[model samples]
Target: MSQQLILVLNCGSSSLKGAVLDNASGDVLLSCLGEKLGLPDAYITFKFNGEKNKVQLSSNPNHTGAVEALMEELKKHGFDSSIAAIGHRVVSGGETYSESILIDEAVIAGIEKCIPLAPLHNPANLLGIRAAQEIFKGLPNVAVFDTAFHQTMPEHAYMYAVPQELYKQHGLRRYGFHGTSYRYVADEAARFLGKDKNSLRMVIAHLGNGASISAIAEGVSKDTSMGLTPLEGLVMGTRSGDIDPAVFGFLADNAGLSVSEATDLLNKKSGLLGLSGLSSDCRAIEEGALEGHPGAKLALEVFVYRLAKYVGSMAVAAGGLDVLAFTGGIGENSDIIRSKVLDYVSFLGFTEDKEANTKARFGNAGVITTADSKAIAVVIPTNEELMIAQDTARLSGL
Candidate 1:
């Protein structure tokens, strides 16, 4: 049997990230990124066989141009014909899809119908799908949604406490994001603990520039942090998470800002950046906090407190926590943050192993809690691209 390779495409508003992975072994054969799309200095960088190369694209390049450039690079690397299918990281499937599936006419319509829910992401996802179809004709295309895993959330957990008509007519309810990362880490946490996923109650915190947490019971999502969009969760790099609805009116009255401007302020200028009045990067905040910067100290404190509170709530939602796992850019790398969070949640019977916590950074995965602790706390690195590639290969029968 020949090797099954999957081309995973993640299209964003201003860039494209593509990776070719071996389905059986989960090894990344090649990866490339096209940046500065729709700009005069658009270019692509490819990394393969431990070597990196950069290629320039036409001025103001679009998704089609990026795909064409990727194809040429693939052919040059002799990986074009080996690809079994293309997988796309779609942001929202709404209620139309519960899991990863092959892309078809009906699927396209469903994605299009959800454009209003994910205006910035769904359109770019569709562009990548269309471009892949045109460039890699006869190949199967799969959509792995960022919201699909959380579809298992009970209605009570997902529903907002709003007027029934608003929810019934406008679909105004919580639809969590970061489903792909949550799903991958949930299974990994189970495997790492030597327990069956269906028997484990896990709370995974995916902390990055964009962050969220999820409660998983028996391998299904029972609750998550993000709601309706990515902006309704824990404090992120710039996006304000979980603010009072009345803040809008307050801003309009005092700041003389319109609703759109207020919304932009919350989504683009708030969170760690707003609270610290410094950089959005967590490392910078940590450094400033260590230096006794009042703004950074306050930001760090609020971020930790909010995260611990959510973790406790999720544990309740899961009926009790057996495992508390951390992943993503911040979660996996920041030992200080992890220690602070663990200190806050010590009542949950987590005793931090300081040495182990410090050693678990830079791609190392291990339990960060003591053996005598009632619950296990671990750092499990997330691999969303591998999850997407596996789903695509399985759906395509590769």
Candidate 2:
């Protein structure tokens, strides 16, 4: 008998990442990401049985087109019949969903209600769901929310200081992002230390294009950096992480910018991109900094400083950190970023082994801290696809 498989789909605004995982063993059999969707260079690169392959579409493919192309690719590999269910990564579940659930009409309605909150993500997520449902008829589908893990945060941590009516009427609060990544890495960090997740106080820093940090005590999220939307967290690649609310009014009055214009500026044109006046990528920024590019050097400094500050704050939220973890693109790959962050927080008795950190990139996991350090620092690669697949399998009983 063939092994059962779970298809996990994570759709961003412009990208769709799909993976086929063994439902019993949770090993990824195939993985792919269709990037540059709706553009001239829209193409897909997938791995089948550990072999990498690329498919460039002659015509620009939307979400539906992308899904159809992937299905065709899977049929070519002769594994299309092995799929048991589909799992989707929905960005915002609001206060409705605290765990992964089977997708149905009501669940689709619930996801649609969150489109106002996750303008860029939820629509694309819904597109993936609708397309998958259409193409894979009769298969069970599950929705795993990215904000679900952080729903454990207390009222004080999630509540904003704005008018109480705003939250009551509009559901305005700190609904953290990257919950799936944090949950995966936090568990991975606990396992790496040979400790139970429920016994450790951990600070998980998920640094990527959209960065956020969470304070977890006893495996439950206590507080997180992102609030309301992903736009309110630590400095991201293009999003302005945190700023005074008055900046909006100031920009309106001084620069003659409207609310939407200001929102676009902050969400699309700020952060390292704005500060460096160059690329938003940390690797490029780091390279530019080494070359004495003033803007790039300043951006790198600001990013490291903000990360260290947030990690220190998270430690307080965790009631004294037992472990510090780095995940996501920047966190897992950029050795310089990790070393700089550890140095800034060395006051907490966290010392990093430079050599160990250098080798922890590209799917490698390791302990990067000294033996005598007060807190353990780990570099754990996150696997949200595996998490989503597990949730799908358990919920579907596949």
Among the numbered candidates, top lDDT falls to 1
The alpha-carbon lDDT assigned to residue 300 of candidate 1 equals 92
Per-residue lDDT tens digits for candidate 2, residues 1-398, read 34588999989877999998887777877889999887877888898767888888656477777888888887997778988999999999999999899999999999999888898899999989998998888999999998999899999899998899999899999999888888888888988899999989999999998899999998999999999888887998999898998999999999999999999999999999999999889899999999999999999999999989999999988999899999999998999999999999999989899899899999799999989999999999998999998899899997
Top-TM-score structure, candidate number? 1
What lDDT does the true structure give each of the candidates? 0.93, 0.90
**List of clashing residue pairs for candidate 2:** none
- In candidate 1, what are the lDDT values of residues 1-398, reduced to their tens digit? 13668999999987899999988788998899999888878888999989999988875388888899999998997888898899999999998888999999899999999898899999999999999999999999999999999999999999999998988887788999999999999989888889999988899999999999999998999999999989997998899999999999999999999999998999899999999999899999999999999999999999999999999999988989989999999999999989999999999999999999999999899999999999999999999999999999999998
- Clash pairs, candidate 1, are 175-228
TM agreement with the true structure for every prediction: 0.98, 0.95
The true-structure Cα RMSD of candidate 2 reads 1.8
